[model samples]
Target: MSALTMPLAVRVIRAEHDALAAMLRTLPLLLAAQRLALVPPDFGALRAMLFYVDEFPERLHHKKESELLFPKLRALVPGLRGTLDDLEMDHAQGERAIRELQHSLLAWEQMGESRRDKFEQQLRVYSTRYLRHMKREETEILPHAVRHFSADDWAELDEAFGGHQDPLAPRAGQAVDEAYAPLRQRILAELPAPFGWGPALGA
Candidate 1:
């Protein structure tokens, strides 16, 4: 069969891979900031990254994988369904991890030392789990799912996220906020770290 006709499950997973790959590189950026203790810490920049964790992959990618992709995989291979269920659990846990990361970032920026220490420890621990989870997916799960997904599904997914408003798209009044006052200036000043600086972090 042609590429587009490949299983929908595979197509969607591949797209998820691409998106995850892009977002994963930001970990180092976060780590850099954590290490440097960059003054006037750009919490906005950090929040923008966290926003993607909640918004893009969680909302779009995981939704498709959990809802659309996994069901069919189970149908084709009965045993596979259990593993897919485990994956769903992983996604669910990821939300809590991101939430914790956000709390730590904000607290650290505000110079709450005890909270910062606690959060940093959690953040590193969570990062390890997240990376390990991704490895499991790429290595153990992707090959089987790929056999079922189609290129058409991948194309459609690509289009949907392509429409996602620019992550850098500030809140409606943000521009005006920057123009009018110092608070706005601080908020606007916290631009996203150079996530685009390196190679295409895609699979």
Candidate 2:
């Protein structure tokens, strides 16, 4: 659907999801290229990226999904209760998972190459699971919402989702927060062409 015609909340959700998915996809490539080139990982950049994921997707995006969107969906379509439950559970686990990832990243950064494989493995698993989770929501949950949600429901959701613009996916004419500027640059710098405007990693 055209952006102008789409519900504001749906637009916000899709944009945030795309931004997150791009970051998630770029991270493995960044790590692998660094490994292949025998370069030390950019620990600061990695930390920034992980912090963005935790701060935006895990905290902000999922908060809206679980507290507002999913509950509304469940109430409107009781048949969706099962899927919504599973998605909510994923949201709950995501906070803990990001914490574990942050810890693993710290360990790898401090403890040398011996800890690298473990962090990489955890990141791969986390990324894969999150991608799948987003796919389910887009395909299953969002379609239902688009069909079922009333004007009032859309207004409420739009107000909540629209209030917080993701730094990685700012709305038109909106500047990213100053606090996130460096983090945003780091991500764009590492993300390869086609996936992002930045230069390819290890190029």
Candidate 3:
């Protein structure tokens, strides 16, 4: 669908998904480069990126999907219950997963090189799962929503999804909120060109 014709909630969700996917793709590269250089991992930047995932996508984006979008879709489609259930399960597990990642990150930071492999492995698993989860939503779930949802449904979903801007992926012309400016900056600064808005890594 054209940008002007698409539902606001759909637009927001896709943009958020794109932003998140970029960050997920960047994490391993960032870690690998640091390791190759024999430089210390920038724990603060890594934390900020992960925290953004937790704070924005996990807390805000997925909550709206679970509470508003998924339930509504389930009611309308009925046939999609299985898929929706799986997505919801992913949502439920997301918090615990992020917390575990954070804990692994801390362990790696505190225990030195021996712990690095564990955190990297966990990150890989988490990223792959999340990427697949989003792919299902976009391909399986969202298309059904587009077909089934009424204008009223879009109205409600738009209100909920559009209420808050993602700090890392603000809409065009929307400035990053001050509260998240530092976190956003840290992430951009850490990630290289194409992956982030900031300068290239090592530049």
TM per candidate comes to: 0.63, 0.95, 0.96
By TM-score, who's the top model here? 3
Clashes of each: 8, 0, 0
**What is the Cα-based lDDT of residue 48 in candidate 3?**
91
Report lDDT per candidate.
0.57, 0.89, 0.90
- Candidate 1 to truth, TM: 0.63
lDDT of 1 by residue, 1-203 (tens): 45576544444455555445544645554455645764444466567666666765667666666765567567766877667778889888877778878877888778755565676577567656666666677666666666654666556545653443323333233242233343323323443334343332231
Tens digit of lDDT per residue, candidate 2, span 1-203?
Answer: 67689998998999998989988888888788879989788788788889999999998999989889998888889998888888889999999999999999999988989999999999999999999999999999999999999999999999999998688899999898888888888877766776766666655
Model 3 residue pairs with clashes: none
Itemize residue pairs with steric clashes in candidate 2. none
Clashing pairs in 1: 6-149, 6-150, 7-148, 7-149, 7-150, 8-149, 8-150, 10-149
* Distance from true location, Cα of 185 in model 3, Å: 0.6
By TM-score, highest first, what's the ranking? 3, 2, 1
| lDDT value, candidate 1, whole model | 0.57
For model 1 the local lDDT of residue 21 reads: 52
